[model samples]
Target: MIEYQTSSFSQDEIRQAAQIQIQELPQGFLSSLGEKPLALIFEHVATSQFGVMVIAKESSNNRVIGYVFGATDTGQLYKDFLIRRTFQAIRYFLPKLLSWDRITKAIETLFYPARKQQKRQDQEECKAELLDLAVVQDYHGKGIAQHLFGEFVEQLREKGVGCFDIPTTAGLDRAHRFYEKMGAIKVGSVIVHEDRPTYIYRYIIQTRKHG
Candidate 1:
């Protein structure tokens, strides 16, 4: 049977679980974060600071298989991330000169809600933002994403969530498809900021039709 967990652990636990080893440069927003590991800080930000839900699954053997993290707009952590990154990039990051401008533009695009939903804005309510989601490579195509997402939605309702958000772009083909499969419809988007061209997607969460 697939088991789900939402317990909290310290930063060290996140690092060990994510299995991230590279010591990324302290540049841009990352730089402002100082010596803390990125993965742990991110987990903390989502669960503790943002009041986001954590959906994770483990096997019968008790090994982690997948997880998704998200938070409400009250945190506004994304905006703060941008400001910190700007300073870090200028000071320490060695970004690809060509890709730098484009990346910045994409960040800006994710800020504003897609204009397509302007008419429905009055009736809709704000929900948590899905900040991160991932499954172990070996566990791919096993309905783990769907399982975790289902549980997360239930948890969201318990938390009084009315809706949720996801950040994606047309360029991120895989992510876009995943959201589509989750029954998320696009509400807004913006062109990535550069000659190379890119776009960001903003998708809203739809509650269970029967529930």
Candidate 2:
């Protein structure tokens, strides 16, 4: 059995989760951002005051099995945290500048038009952003992802976030299917490199009317 709870910004759990992301996911710059991926994840979680972090723990061992990270209102997410993470990235990647792949990847990551930042510029539509979601390999094929996303939508709804957006690479077919199943519409997409497209998906949460 697995139990879900809001994370308390526990470094250990976040570090464990980050390690999984680095090892399992093909994140261009994130893999090269810092010696410890946990630091970057922690910085974002800690600075994004109103963002959400949910953790799933196995009942038998009380170990974190999966996690989801998102924001309720992204208009202010980058206002304060961008500089710090950027500087950290620069510091870490400076030594590895000789690698062309690392250099190109860093440039791409820095300028990537993340949906949240774009939503902030709109100023009219209040949109939330699902930043990152991941489940450990061993925990795959379970409904943990669905449950986590369900709870995520509920939490964002409670905070008055009606519209949501997420950016994903074209290769993540499973994620595309899941978002489509959740009623998310593909708003737009941009081709970063040959055969590598970044698709933007948005989901609108219907608000309840009170009599």
Candidate 3:
């Protein structure tokens, strides 16, 4: 049996989630930062008020198997991570700066959203986002991803968010399909990491009517 919940996760659970992140999302930039740094980022997100993380665990062993984490305000989340975890972030990311490609990607990540905002001022409503969602390989096709998504949406609604965005790379068909299946609308596309094309999707939460 598997249990899914959004709460203050322990350090061990955060570590497990970080490992799964690295194993499952190998192509992501953060995954390349290594496990310890990723784990620290997860911890920061889990503890921050503007962020939310839903973790799935095996009920039998209380082992974390999957997780979906994001921030209510992605811009603010990054800012806080840089400010509050300055030293740690520098320690982990400084080594990667030796590569010019890494430096470019870092600059793009920091400024891409702002650039997108300038181009699409009409999409000002898309302040929140679903950052990362992943399930253990063995747990795929068991509906764990869907369940985690639902929980994340609920948490966002409770926090008074009306809409959220999801950005995925062009070739990730499965991810695109899943987002579409969950009723997200593809709004547009943008280039990130210099030449990598990414699609942006938006999901609007339907508010429940009070009788």
Candidate 4:
């Protein structure tokens, strides 16, 4: 009953669906939301998947079950955010990478976790990222997440983008295992959240024609 659709950005449905599991999502996840009049990072999604963001719906109930948001063209956004938050980054990243294990264990104690984060120089090769993904608790175990992910990945593949990201919380071992089993690589964690038990993970999507 899940129906995938393009993100409107104006409809509260996407944000509402996300609120169902917002606390479970990562930080820096929605920093783009409040930045401008439009507020979200990706507004174009082909209006489908490649436009940057999308939402999944349940036809029978007419409810938005979940959503995944991302855009590859935001190098400037990340670069600017990092510069503006330089002090916080310096103060936090050191201990984060230093005590990754401990942080991973107590991530629920951490604030809204990040499903993605600042990237390294080498990772600039990666294009899109899974900023935040959430399915309503009542809709869990019904393959909703997979459906949403499939739509997003397929769209990115069509665009010729290869690599993407999926940030995870160590406390949510089940989630980490899910993405890994789905083919994502554990490149490492964000230095700021290493000690906090949260990590920024990555995945590669082959071209649509090839995949």
Q: Which residue pairs in candidate 2 collide?
A: none
Q: Please report how far candidate 3 places residue 202 from its true position, in Å.
A: 0.5
Which regions in candidate 1 have their CA more than 4 angstroms from the true location?
A: 10-13, 20-36, 55-62, 78-127, 191-211
Local error of candidate 1 at residue 128 (angstroms): 2.5
Once fitted onto the true fold, the runs of candidate 4 whose alpha carbons sit more than 4 angstroms away are 23-51, 77-119, 122-124, 194-197, 209-211
Higher-TM-score candidate among 1 and 4? 4
Taken over the whole model, the C-alpha lDDT of each candidate is: 0.54, 0.69, 0.88, 0.57
Q: Compare the candidates by lDDT and give the number of the best one.
A: 3
Poorest 10 consecutive residues of model 4 by lDDT? 32-41
Residue 72 C-alpha lDDT in model 2? 70
lDDT of 3 by residue, 84-164 (tens): 989988887788677888788888888766766775687565878898999989989999999999999999999999999
lDDT of 2 by residue, 46-94 (tens): 4466677777778787687777777775545644456557777556447
RMSD, candidate 2, Å: 3.6
Go through the candidates in order and give the clash count of each. 9, 0, 0, 16
Tens digits of per-residue lDDT for model 4 on 83-152? 5545654564434435555445334223222333334555454646676567777778888888777887
Report the alpha-carbon TM-score of model 3 versus the true structure. 0.95
RMSD of each: 6.4, 3.6, 1.3, 8.5
lDDT of 1 at 190: 35
**Model 2 segments beyond 4 Å from truth?**
32-35, 73-75, 83-93, 96-100, 114-126, 192-195, 208-211
